[model samples]
Target chain A: MLSIEHLTLQLPYYTSWWRRRWAEVLSDVSLELHPGEVHAVVGASGAGKSLLAHALLGLLPEPKHQTGRLTFQNRALTAARQRQLRGRELALIPQSLDALDPLVRSQRQVSWAASRAGHARSDAWQAAGQALTHYQLDERGRQAFPHELSGGMARRVLTAMAHVSHAQLIIADEPSVGLDPQQRNRVLDALAALALEGKSVLLITHDLRHALPIAQQVTLMNQGRCIETACASAFRGDGDTLATGYARALWQALPDNHFGVLTTTQAQNVA
Target chain B: MLSAYRLHHAFADQTAVLDNVSLSLEAGEWVGLNGLSGAGKSTLGQLLAGHLTPQAGVIKVDGAAPPRSGLQPVQWLPQSPELSVNPRWRVKRILEEAWTPSTALREAFGIEPGWLNRYPSALSGGELQRVCVLRALAPGVRYLIADEISSMLDPLTQLALWQALRQVADERRLGVLVISHDAALLERLCPRRLTLSEGRLSPPARHGAQSA
Candidate 1:
């Protein structure tokens, strides 16, 4: 389990020797992840969803100030502890395919992750093959380089690598971008299956429709602030049960829904 | 009018990515191309925009071959706007190099004045994409091929972009080809839709004739 309490991050820009301006990138964010549950964080482009992920992973940019209480498995998550847990107990499924090495074969890359997670080399290789197969990659696909794979195939390879590590918590950041509807559903279903196996997942995305089916709980963020956290079931049938006006507006804007007008706050936050 | 006839393309592996595909667009018409991933929809867009030469068949605008040099009437907006522009160049240079957009056009696209001096890396993906859309709608462009241009953007930004594009197309009578996997978006923006499957282009289906 993971819990973040009142997390805040600020970046300082020095205008002069003694004058500095601080920009608040994240503010008073709190979230809790239970074991075997899929929690989704949905927001627009500048809503700081990815920033929250980086902060949790200890991958935030420098020249910043951070204050937060993060606990994992009932233990405080210090920087050292994060480094120790990273890639073993916690793993990130990065948004870009460039996270993969262009020259390395897909299976080999996955095996490397297994090796890092403390598997023997021979065992790592075997697990990598199984992992690739589990993700529906074929024999040729396992041997293909990252560039040789299609967008959907490359995404599956990333998922395979993450699974081979056997991380307890997987942070997937927009894993379905550029994918077709079927491929998108496949990726989401794979994540859901991971949860079914008792792994906690934090699904970060802009599309609420994609997130609604698999997500047990949803947190709505806007302009670096967490607006509301509600049950995924609450986001249906006109959004009357939703707490905030912005959240209701977002729900209404869905194509399958009314496709209604966006509130000024929603429009400004999005554009 | 813009037309492609029996277009065929293959890569070094000698496998056809596109086969005998053909489509056409009349002036002021917004057409949608829908397909699954790796279905050669992007390859067909590239061929129509003259970014790639087909092994066989022909693509013509007004029954003439697409111009190889000078100001092109057909323009392409790729999925990744960051890759389309020169990173070293300032945003002002990138915009002016293509064509000087009217002041109204820049404002309508929500391009900030300060952004003009910054490099591409300093801008966000949505901002960069707005610049790319503006560049594609430059003076001489008559037909626009937007290949998943708004796929990475959020819903509100995506809606803003499509609205701006529709307004521009109507005012300029530009023939626009929007390539996307989003059926909702395709239905909303285009009256005529074409589906591509297994290296083939299906006949156009006239959906709702109602205006967006």
Candidate 2:
């Protein structure tokens, strides 16, 4: 349902008043997502994983940023189309807990999301509560303000907001952070259920173990570049089936695995 | 040893998050705290680090009240490094806010020199976490409450971080309380693990078929 091809984004800054310099933070990122499937984009901290998400959502702040193609459902995702489709056909579960409004309670924020997603005004609140409950937020959690809620609670509320939306594509950015084992599994299962419901899920995360189970396709990134894209099955057994050395090394680094360290070159580049 | 006796805490209009919880750790040992989210693991960590005072219990470091002023002996590294840092400050200033970490320590944490001039907002989540963890290791700091600090990092980075921390922690003989949801990670990092649930602390019963 969503496709990005050779998408690159560069932000310009002026070293001096006369000279403008561009930093290519995102480079040559390409991926495909289909209905009823979950695609995971995994990478290190500065590997520009989140940048790719922003690029797809047309949230890139650069005016001169365009060197690739983004198509959704057979139509080009132009700037205007991105604005028109955001929050209705496309919803982003932001990485930060700061995305939730501090003044509003969790349920109210989710209700607003449901209302914007074409739910009737009268049904919005009920839909929000159901979504929150589905995501494992109890009644007290739903009533707590963003600051009052724990980090994990706030993140679930964001996922709940996306869940209540009528969006066909959900971009969940690090939805598993700060959650316990059970809560993390619940969120991942919920995302898988979304895909089972025929909605496309683009899960952006750093944990391969958690994402590999539900993700049909895994895109590995390093230093703003796509390292490899492979089926999730390629991650098993010493990662020998994986296409690249970096992917194998990442898989080995899991605590349950060999706990492999990054090679000198890859380590130096990300820092 | 650092110890807490019968700690009790609850938020306004909320049930007790921590009920009669007590834990202790030696100066040269590593312990892991595993719990579901909202099970009061953070509250317990905060109380131990003196960030919060318990309603009914006392925390003592080396048989004395933990000093509320001066350099804290027990430091708590929060889960969200971005929120714990100053957005306007450069990475260098934030890393050096409490004390200056040496070149070797900086390298150990995989902090590049180029990032020092960039603002905290410019660094990715894992990079900022490295800075925060290193900053909390300033001199005179004895215990560390590392609360889900590596959950946002990739596996390789996570392994590297633990290896580096182990080296430093061993050298300094610093006690650490690792709080995380990843049971495998906790098992790898700590020899002793505790699980917090229902406002109480107990040993995790999962074994034989340990899984994430």
Candidate 3:
């Protein structure tokens, strides 16, 4: 379980030339993620989803200001403990597939993760193989280097790492990004499967169409603020037209879709 | 122009990740590659772009083999735009690495002069992505391979980049192979689609058909 209270982060040098002017990335935002549940964070671009991920994982770059109480379960995660928790109690599946080590074999990176967490190399190999297989990766894939694999393969390798580490909490940013339709399904299914197995997932994405269906709870962030949080099933159903409206707005915002534009022009004409 | 003939590649005992896959692109053509996870879409792209060699097949770009491994005859805009840039390099230096002022690269992406000096870390994800794309388009390549280039971008930026890519490809008579999971975007951009499965390549199912 995870909980955040009155979190605020600012970066004075983010806009460099501005000097004394500080740019606020995340405002007084707060939320909770529970075991056996998938909490989705949704927002438009620049809504601070990735910024929040970096802050929560204590990976925010230097000269950044962070003031908040981040408690995992019940204990406060101070600077030192947060660093230790990054790869041990918490795991991250980065937005990019190439986040894997290009020079290292897929197995080696997993082994490194396991070894750093005090597990033996052989155990890590076995766990990595098993995790890869769980994500539908077969024998050949388990031995391939990062560059040798495709986008989807690299994603699967990362998912396998998350699973093998068995981190208590997994923070996945844009888990379905760059995947094809079928691969999107696989990635979503894998995350859902993890939730079903009692792991907590904080899925950060801008696409609600995919996350809304799979996540048990949803939190919408706008301009670094936690605007809304509600039950996923109910939110998709009758009670909350807001989430549905937002989803429709995003679908309309899709650049290549002429249908939305046509409909809007028609409405203007009729009016 | 780009073409692949009976391309086949694999790491080991398993079936080739790209099994005898063949495809071709002519000037001004925009193709989309779609498939399930681990189905070899990127592999096929890399092979066509000369990033990887086929174990038993042939690839030709403008009637010749690509110049180098991991190098595409066309420019490539990878998924993670932020990491693609060198942290210490200023945006001007980063953009300069791929383009020369003698070329019309800046005009293609509408990149104004002032943005060149800022480091990538200072920019937003969308901003960085745009820069990466502009850098890719800076060179006068006749073709492009974009691997989920818009995944990290927001809907607005996504749409803008989509239009820019289409426009540039048209203006330069360039061929483009865009890889993404967004079915709707693929439907809107590409007249032809390539579907991969079990490490094999073939034509996509009809529009609205079930996903692989």
Best by DockQ: 2
- lDDT of all predictions: 0.86, 0.88, 0.75
Can you give the lDDT of residue A204 in candidate 1?
A: 89
Off by over 4 Å in 2: A12-21, A136-138, A262-271, B203-212
Best by lDDT: 2
Best-to-worst lDDT order: 2, 1, 3
> How does each model score on TM-score?
0.92, 0.93, 0.75
Higher DockQ: candidate 2 or 3? 2
Q: What fraction of the correct interface contacts does each predicted structure contain?
A: 0.37, 0.92, 0.52
Interface DockQ per candidate: 0.48, 0.70, 0.36
- Residues A1-271, candidate 3, lDDT per residue (tens digit)? 8999989999865335555657788999899999999999987667899889888888886887899899997999778888998777888988766578788888777777777666787887777666777888776777888877766678778877777777889998888876666777888889998899999999999776678778988887766888778676644322335444444344455644342333443343221
Q: How displaced is residue A19 in candidate 2, in Å?
A: 7.6
Which ten contiguous residues of candidate 3 chain A have the minimum total lDDT?
A: A262-271
Per residue, candidate 1 scores C-alpha lDDT tens digits across B41-63 of 89989888999988999889978
- Least accurate 10 contiguous residues by lDDT in model 2 chain B: B203-212
Q: What is the TM-score of chain A alone in each candidate?
A: 0.94, 0.93, 0.87
Q: Chain B TM-score for each model?
A: 0.94, 0.94, 0.85
